[model samples]
Target: DVGCGYEAARQMRRRGRIAPQHWPHVVAASRRLGIAGVSYEWLAGRAAMQRAAVMQGEAA
Candidate 1:
């Protein structure tokens, strides 16, 4: 059965046997936690959205 590749990547990293391909998935894995990610533009967009939301809240 298929398993969690990101979890595998994490274990591999802990064991010092990670591969380059595992990086993006691993990085994206904890993105919401802001631990890491592969999307620079996505992060920027999220920041912009949050900023706008805060500004709107202030204007309310």
Candidate 2:
């Protein structure tokens, strides 16, 4: 569940997204889970691509 939550946050951070007020919660969770080597930029790019795909699907 921690991984899923973190991925969700990463996706949400794409496309000029703002940091959530509860960001501390995510940090705490990641620290607790000992998650390492996370790359925000990569996640953002991936999320942007996913968002584009969804948008294209809707348009189609």
Candidate 3:
């Protein structure tokens, strides 16, 4: 899900990426999704766990 990156992901306006104005909400959304934290490694680990859970659900 793009969430707030829909426009950027689609390359709307030729930016092909998120604009500066969207940073705050993007970071907020990332935090809410458990993908952002005090440590980059922590975030990666959490994301891996979440991804595995999602894939497991799909397999089920």
Segments in model 3 whose C-alpha atoms lie over 4 Å from true places = 1-37
Candidate 1 per-residue lDDT over residues 1-60, each given as its tens digit: 113566875786585543445445545665645764446455456557767888999999
Q: What's the best-to-worst order under lDDT?
A: 2, 3, 1
In the predicted model 2, the residue pairs found to clash are none
In the range 1-60, model 2's lDDT, one tens digit per residue, is 233466666776664442444444545666677876434554466558778988999999
As a TM-score, model 1 comes out at 0.39
**Cα RMSD to the true fold for all candidates:** 12.6, 7.5, 9.8
Which run of 10 residues does model 2 get worst, by summed lDDT?
15-24
Residue runs of model 1 more than 4 Å from their true location after superposition: 1-37
Superior candidate under lDDT, 1 versus 3: 3
Error of 3 at 16 (Å): 24
lDDT of each: 0.57, 0.58, 0.58
Query: Order the candidates by TM-score, highest first — what do you get?
Result: 2, 3, 1
Could you tell me the TM-score of candidate 2?
0.40
Q: Which pairs of residues clash in candidate 1, taking residues 3 or more apart in a chain or in different chains?
A: none
